[model samples]
Target: MTPVDTVDLWVIPLDRPGDETRTAPHLDCRESARADGLAPPRRGRFVVARGATREILSGYTGVEPKGLVWRVGQWGKPYVELRQDTAPVPAFNLSHCGAVAVLAVLRNGRREVGADIERVVGGRAERLVERFFHPDEARYVRGFAPAGREAEATRLWTRKEAYAKASGHRLLDVLHMPVLAPRPGRRPGRGDGTDTGAVRRLRDVPFDDGWAVSVAVMGSADFDVAPRLWPEGP
Candidate 1:
């Protein structure tokens, strides 16, 4: 609550029990919000986001999940009041793609984080990259065009989007980062590595699959990604 767990990721399989519900995973997040001494979220979307959040926080606190009051910013970001008198603690971000939702937790009062997931469909990856991304990024994928051009494009797109989301920059801002250079690569731990992964700048923004996974962290110190699945309550 005061400090924060180191940057790490916990990806949950939606197929598992207590891993598929909308709010089940986040119950743990709310517990942390409360354990940290924050007021529970009263209601609205904040409640849903809060619930999803609780599930991720559960990993750290290992506490029973509970519903708490939550608040939202103008841009639809969620925040839990850690205390009645003090301002909310560290900021958080959330993104969902099909069956997957990625949550980013920050410790240093971050204001926003946006993540987008796009499933790659056939050759659409190449076309999209040409249309939306910078010339350099396009070139990076083209280099791999002979072997498997589509996959190349998808990886660049996700990394680019993740970087954009972290920057809180608009879809247009992705251009600021070089698209031609094949995105910064992060050699997956050999065996368990993603087919696509790379780090951009010092923020550690990386993603795989031109399916277009992107995240922008709005001015924060720490970041972690947690995959949430609905939890079953009996």
Candidate 2:
């Protein structure tokens, strides 16, 4: 069997009290949160998410979470910035929804990573597809039985968002782009389309209780993903 690159995914619960204490020392993170002008609860979520991200990255780099520097791309993607002599940096991305946050870490710093978690709620799935999905994707969603349409739409939406995040593109930029269905058991190097050289894969995060989470990684190397809930404690 071909060796696959691996990524570590950490899922964190925002409701925990310890998250605050763990992340509070990162004053820069707090400044960013305060700048958002979000309400208290929303700001709290931001603090936890930002803290979790730093804590996770620090675990791998041995750098204090607050000491790590970041650079944002023109399109709003954020990545760690490392000095030339610094040890290999890891690529990471963060996403949160409802009461949870997901952080994806790619050891190969050259690769790009993106993640998104969405709460599943009742809505007019068909109408949403028409508004947000690519023309072909919308038709594909509609083809599903009405009963399954919403689930299918949610899955595809995650896929689309994941891809956009990995590519460092905004969701709006790729909403209309064609997304190929995932192929099972395919070799890692196989190209699905014109962009085959970049490894792109999406996996369902087994989130119970009405949540959908997906992570996307893009690079030349094939990767395996290991997902785990954040361990208790700071």
Candidate 3:
């Protein structure tokens, strides 16, 4: 089990060779059917992302990846079904964009946790801010210079997405929600040493340039994020 105050954030690169072949065998029927229905690269990516998720969770649960069953919530969140398992299962959420997939696993007695990653695209930032962002969040993005606007926008976008996923709320419903307020004694954009120390607060997860990552969890206690790359499979 993960430490009570820690959330494991796994950053996975989905383009590795034989990713599909290696992970495919571990996917259950529904996932395989879903992959079969998708076209070219999307099918391949889906296979890798879902398969990798199962593999990672398996390491924690002592269950084979194929033995894991998933159930979806009314709000469209997917959760593992622990129908027959006696071991504790970690709460987790997954998001993938471009060639990278991110998973956030929480074993701290919190069931609501989410993670997201997005490629930074400057041209669409202003328009999205104007349309969906809260007034404060919009201003936060606008406060950045043109050169920095996209990264700021992407950061805020990921945070909002992570929160929405964690809360089981529709993205459209929470798009206007504010996420700009910083927790006491914490600085924005610094995930390494900053702790939200409470629920409903967003944490910015540092990632490679050109990509933005964020994780959100529910609870009224302090928690820290430990980011690590997904280890290469044998």
Candidate 4:
């Protein structure tokens, strides 16, 4: 496991050929039931996402992927229920969009982390900005060139999403949270409606084409985000 100062980000391709066949065997009964509830394409994606989550967590915990137990929070976030004797129980969060899934793990200790990925699509941003985004963030997206609005909106959306997940709050509840560094000297967190006392750090994660990714970590100090492709070694 890595140090708490670094958050490991794993990029997983949900539609990769043969991934489902290989990872399906590791799903617990609950995960299997959830996967079974989904329709095609989505079902396949769910299987790949959860299965890969197990495989990735297994690397750090030494627990077989299927053996890892999960508990759900009141807000619907999933937590890995490790033994009290376990030396390092990593905090993690996962998000997926289109064909890609991203997982963030803060290893060697419990530190809240969240990740979000979204396909860059046009036209959806304008209305979402009007309804969900904080005024400052909406202005930021609108300030972008007409052609750049969608990408900027996607970036802002991912940041808001990552922050929500990191704080274990619902998206709608935190939709008013401003994620941008509003002015030159100002940082993004305080006065952004964060009721949680933990300080939040947000950053954009570089990944493959057609996707925008971002990660959020809650701590007083900043943490480096180490990104890597899934099914690959440390």
Tell me how many clashing residue pairs each candidate has: 41, 2, 0, 0
lDDT scores in order: 0.49, 0.71, 0.78, 0.82
Off by over 4 Å in 3: 1-4, 183-199, 232-234
List candidate 4 segments past 4 Å from native. Answer: 1-4, 182-193
lDDT of predicted model 4: 0.82
In candidate 3 the C-alpha lDDT for residue 189 amounts to 37
Residues 1-234 of candidate 4 have per-residue lDDT tens digits of 644489899888899899999899999998899998999899999999999999999998988899888998888889888764654688999998877789999886556888899888876865698677878778777787898888778877888899889888899887887788656324444333367565788888777666778888877566788887899953
Give the Å shift of residue 216 in candidate 3: 0.2
Candidate 2 lDDT score at position 1? 86
Is 3 or 4 the stronger prediction by TM-score?
A: 4
List the RMSD of every prediction in angstroms.
Answer: 10.0, 3.3, 4.6, 2.9
Q: Per-residue lDDT for 99 in model 1?
A: 47
lDDT rank, highest first? 4, 3, 2, 1
Per-residue lDDT for 32-67 in model 2, tens only? 758368776777788788877877887878788788
